[model samples]
Target: MGAIESAAQAAAWLLAALTRELGLFAAIGLAVGGLDDLAVDGLWIGRSLWRRATVYRRHARMTMATLPPPEEPGAIAIFIGAWSESAVIGAMLRAALAGIRHGDYRIYVGTYPNDPETERAVLGVGDARIRRVGGVLPGPTTKAECLNRIWQSMLADERASGRRFKAIVLHDAEDVIHPHELDLYDRMIERFDLVQIPVLPLLANESRWAWTISATYADEFAESHQKSLVLREAVGAAVPSAGVGCAIQRAMMARIAEQGGGLPFSADSLTEDYELGLRVRAMGGRSAFIAMPVAPGKGLVAVRAHFPETIEAAVRQKTRWIIGIALAGWDRLRWDGGVTERWMRLRDRRAPIAALVLAVAYGALLLSIVCRIAGIRPDWPDALEPILTLTGALLVWRLAMRALFVTKAYGWREGLCAIPRVFIANIIEIAAAWRAVLHYVPGTTPIWDKTRHRFPERVGE
Candidate 1:
């Protein structure tokens, strides 16, 4: 009986210590991260409203002038690197062949020699516009390396045909290309060296859990593509490439290749596309993030693809992103830009800290429940109350903005679902952050962490 009492007392003391320490840590993290998020929210809202009132109102012609389909659109070279993507490559190529309205473009699909299944699928597409570029290396090389081989293939083709590609577009094997995507790229690429269109994840109607997990991506991307990237570009910040639905000037690609020692994409980096856009901006190349409708009644010319619908897959995908942007990216890309650009970089690298805060916050919540069941109430500290309240308010504002943007992109039902989906997103992010730390800290070889993809039956509809 005495040992049982002693054990219970020790557990209570341990719980109290964990609760206090975690609360203090969480408070500091929340104060910093919350304020940063609040600043971005203010900037997005204030800048958007100001532009609508002044710049947009001053030039009615700006809103009125619509770009017509180009009669002589320049030839575009599309690069798609595939390893074990046999499942969706054929469907994606077929959709792109049928859907794209532009006449002057060729797709260079890079395939590994060992990945015969994927190679066979690309060959099975049997379109003249699709050129299958055999990989020099075996299967499972980095995505950047694969893309570089495709670039080499394009260069060889240019040499053989005596035709120069006007622009180079990058895409994954699972993407559902928009019909007017090339048109938008053709019109915009003439002005901006890099043109990035919005990317929206297609929501899968599977099991309830699957639907919720997939909706988390929809909520995040809807808010991010509509609000975050728009604001980043509006504030004169360099827009990072989404690696899909983006076009870069062929000249700029050549310059980038020359600077990077004959490779336009970095073979050593995981997020080569993200770095490519920043590098272009650093080299005085103009970049733009466009979210405009192709026609009055038609939807915006955005790339649509299915994101990971399972927690494990989502974690694996996000783990690569966290490592590339937050960990490895910091070492590769310098923080050398304007105030807004630096701020955006900080936001990009805040994933680990955000994950830590989230874990501590959840831990505190669980401990509080344990204390309550044990009839142990924590001593309320008055000093931390204001900070906690402010952070709580900021969190509410963040969620409200997420819902607003999601509702604008999706419907009100998804907007409401976005509220609870925050928790789901947080869980996946925390897991990814942990995995990224483990994977990156040990200095393991970074390979292409490819996620399995699915193509919707009604693609390009």
Candidate 2:
């Protein structure tokens, strides 16, 4: 056939794929995804309005008070699992040691035998407060396994020092510890078994058009920590740890350890921090997620770090998250919780499916564009009118919610930028989700896909 005729044939195939796939399956997927997001939106909005009407109004909007440090602060163990983190570990340790206000704390850096560079970096810190623990396995093992070894090191140190840690804090090698976070954890762990502080992503120094990955992290964490997590705790759903800025009370860890065959952190899971919180809740432990301002000048008490700046790095990091939380978590945790818990779990598990929907939706758009460019109009069925309209409306609502949350975290600039970055975020997430779903087999173990990170120049003291 001639070139023009071949082009027409391809266009025809594209339209057929769009009509058959999108009309039959993607439409329903879109609607279901909309409803799932709507549920969270409803909870977030309702909780916000209620708190504004009651708690904030009653307290006169003065949450940042001159809080006292623990009179007798208990020892705290800080665990950081390092894999290929030689580039950032030393700087992170120095910043953390310098910034932390609490004196009764020890930092343990877990390093694999194969990763000598990271071990050397950790050793170079040479601070009496920092201890480097060799990993049980070689490099690039699952983070959960490394954390388990870190916990063991914490226990050994506890035995040697004759001082028990009141609580154990979790952190990453790239984290810039906030000055007030340890103090906050010190104060809060007294009341709750598990305490989680907000995690903020630091934007890169370079000005570039291709850095939407950083913005995606900023937007997601801002909304999640500010709204979703708070709402989840209010509704009695389990609070998943951000893997940084999280602390579990010593006694709570002991209890979870007792339950998990002497290992509080599961070696089988990719998202151990997430599972830790949920499993603790399952064992009837109290958890707190506090987002209030820590100091008079500083905003919330949060661990700040720069996320993966490039697309490949971002997708690899997010793929681990999706695999651990959505897929592996579902397989392990199963559906065992109250109404609120079940609802939240459903939202969490919906990620892979929603990602597929995103892929299909974008594919449909591309097909339509190609057809239009080829001067071929698609004769979509009239039955899809309502489905298309509702899906469009839901997409708008989702975007609006995302923008508002991003605005609350960053500023109006980022909020407006989030509108465009939404597409970029979805594309990245779809790629990650595909890998996550495809990587798992019935009895096979998942490989650790670690994301390399960098420390920003400035982290608040």
Winning candidate number (TM-score): 1
Per-residue alpha-carbon lDDT of candidate 1 for residues 286-388, written as tens digits (9 for 90 to 100): 9998888755555778999989999999999999999989998888886999898999999999999899999999998898898888887666467678878
Candidate 2 lands at a TM-score of 0.93
TM-score of 1: 0.95
Cα lDDT of candidate 1 equals 0.88
- Score residue 325 of candidate 2 by CA lDDT: 83
Q: For each candidate in turn, give its C-alpha RMSD to the true structure in angstroms.
A: 2.0, 2.7
lDDT of 2 at 45: 85
* TM-score against truth, every candidate: 0.95, 0.93
What residue pairs are clashing in model 2? Answer: none
- Model 2 alpha-carbon drift over 4 Å, by segment: 1-17, 20-24, 60-64, 68-72, 207-210, 373-379
Can you tell me which runs of candidate 1 are displaced by over 4 Å? 1-10, 60-65, 68-72, 441-444
Cα distance off (Å), candidate 2, residue 78: 0.5
Error of 2 at 213 (Å): 2.0
Per-model lDDT = 0.88, 0.83
Residue pairs clashing in model 1 are none
